[model samples]
Target chain A: MGPITGEQIAEKLSLTRATLRPDLAILTMSGLLEARPRVGYFHSGKFPHQIVAKKIQSLLVADIKSVPIVVSEKCSVYDAVVTMFIEDVGTLFVVKEGGLLEGVISRKDLLKTTLGGQDIQKLPVGVVMTRMPNVLFTHTEESVWSAAWKLITHEVDALPVVRKVAQPDGSDGYEVVGRLSKTNITRLFVELGEGN
Target chain B: MGPITGEQIAEKLSLTRATLRPDLAILTMSGLLEARPRVGYFHSGKFPHQIVAKKIQSLLVADIKSVPIVVSEKCSVYDAVVTMFIEDVGTLFVVKEGGLLEGVISRKDLLKTTLGGQDIQKLPVGVVMTRMPNVLFTHTEESVWSAAWKLITHEVDALPVVRKVAQPDGSDGYEVVGRLSKTNITRLFVELGEGN
Candidate 1:
């Protein structure tokens, strides 16, 4: 089929556009379809099963990333630990004043700090974090395959999903918007398996 | 529809029976179909997208769990750490002489032990592991949904997939045969999304 509008899809499904948006987004992210700003949606001509060999490369980050569990860089390690447990997430993104991506921390980092017998409440997570250069991140437009690969290769649980924005200093920096983890992928898998 | 055999499926797909066994196994694991000992395979009539809500209740742990990455309980924490890194897993199963799981060790545990400045070579992983009463496990016949739920609820990356066997001591215990992780679920999800 040629490009079809969301309105057309909604009509065909007999559901409101709002009700179908999420599913549409998932389909778009998985690379089954392409969406254009004003044109409409078009089939990618790639069958669903074809996604396996390509590693779901057509599914973009924007469709699957979840809101990030973040902590300010200046937050104490103790608070970071608490946040992690409270959020029930393995990794936390460290962000700056304007919510720009700063660093990343994992349970191992916190456990190491705790084992040091250092005052967790006094130590800033910034000091204990895997700093920016070492932090592996992904952009919203990038493929989920690459994002998942980073998780596997880097051996980390989560990735900060960000978008590049102009910095005040005339440099380019990433602004953290969401997070992606194995859980998100698994959840998506279950969704697809359920055929929903 | 009704009872079908692997040979039938293989013929329909134009694939040899040998080449189709693995796919059949995956389908059984995902609850798309069922296998009867001498009766052959039968359609479950459950669609793939429906798997999300039921969490793949029809898919058994035996169908999807992968080989476990294990370390001896008597092994040094340092060696355990090395094994974990080498295996590229976040958790390690500390098994006994006969390969019975004794405890579970995570990256956090090893890091904590390391940061304590304790001699990694002398300390056994058993001392740092989450022992018997606290370890979360799954039975071979149990559903993958429950396994996935345990992973999410416990906020752990992997689960020891086991089978109950009579011990020499006249008691019953679990024998680790495989492991189920977020990766496994995600991979399954990708496979399903690909319609493979």
Candidate 2:
């Protein structure tokens, strides 16, 4: 009646009991789920439907308040911190000659860059910036899952939700705007399933 | 003032403006984003982040639920449907005996198993299932972003969030509950940025 047991799992998977145990052990150690003695496995069921949705949105960078404090393609770490704070964000979407989303600079990236014993005053954010090749981005309209996918694969917290739009000067197209880490999906899930 | 001009993006992304045109066209057509030919690019500021999250979550099944339903793994398709509905989920977490997580089954898997000349009453969900060695999962307590990443990188929709814990016999641990699709993350973000 409860969750299927490990024994049940083995039968269902068509694998010998011995092989699957180790795999299960690794999972158990991570706290993703837990098992009871004889009763069977029980899901925490913490993250409900709504919370998952919220976490996905928080990672978006579009419509975020602008921080004009960032003066250059390479700004001071001091100024980067200021920009993030003023914008009430943890990361910054770095741009170049046009409004295209060039790269990203997070408080962590800036701090990590500075911690490397680099000259703070002379260093441009570009030096510490996660360049285009190194960055993970989503279109301004990618599904939350798509964005989440980029974050997880890139091992970063935010994604530049860029948009490729036609040019006014009779040029071609370009990217603009970005999405950053806006919410913790797990936390939101946990909260939604709180009362249930 | 509006989205960064295409010229800016070309310089920053290091790509020719022509090459990027298709991606822009596709994004706009897909309704994931919007654009202004002369002004700039813009998202609807109304994409249902939660629904999008749900759609993505639907893709993260590490196991196939349809197998059991099709094969009548000791039950009826009606029962399987009930299980799916009760869990408020569309996929079933497949497992092996001894509490190890196996492949997962989604509605698509079920339907596929019963497709064409296949008979639902006699088929096992496993037959049409996306099987092991290709299944993706998440660790217990992994970050939402990281978990979402696994779903994305692997092109999946859900993860069986597993963990290890005392097995009542005071032994070691085992795999347990699934985190599945995290819908809450998207929901929260959309609500917080309603009509943005």
- Proportion of native contacts kept per candidate: 0.33, 0.05
B24-83 per-residue lDDT for model 2 (tens digits): 554444333367777655443323343344334443233311122122334433344446
> Which runs in model 1 stand beyond 4 Å of their true positions?
A1-48, A51-64, A75-79, A111-124, A140-146, B1-67, B71-87, B108-129, B139-146, B187-196
Residues A35-147 of candidate 1 have per-residue lDDT tens digits of: 99888997566543454445445678898889899999899988898797677778899998788888999876776576566887899999999998778999899887767
Docking class of 1: incorrect
DockQ of each: 0.23, 0.03
Local distance difference test values of all predictions, in order? 0.75, 0.50
lDDT of model 2, residue A178? 42
Residue-level lDDT tens digits of model 2 in A1-196: 2465888776655667797676455333322235778866544332223333444445433333123222357677556655665565556777766676666786556544543545666777777777776667666455555555555445565566666766778754446454544334433333323322
Instruction: Give, for candidate 1 chain B, the lowest lDDT window spanning 10 residues.
Output: B47-56
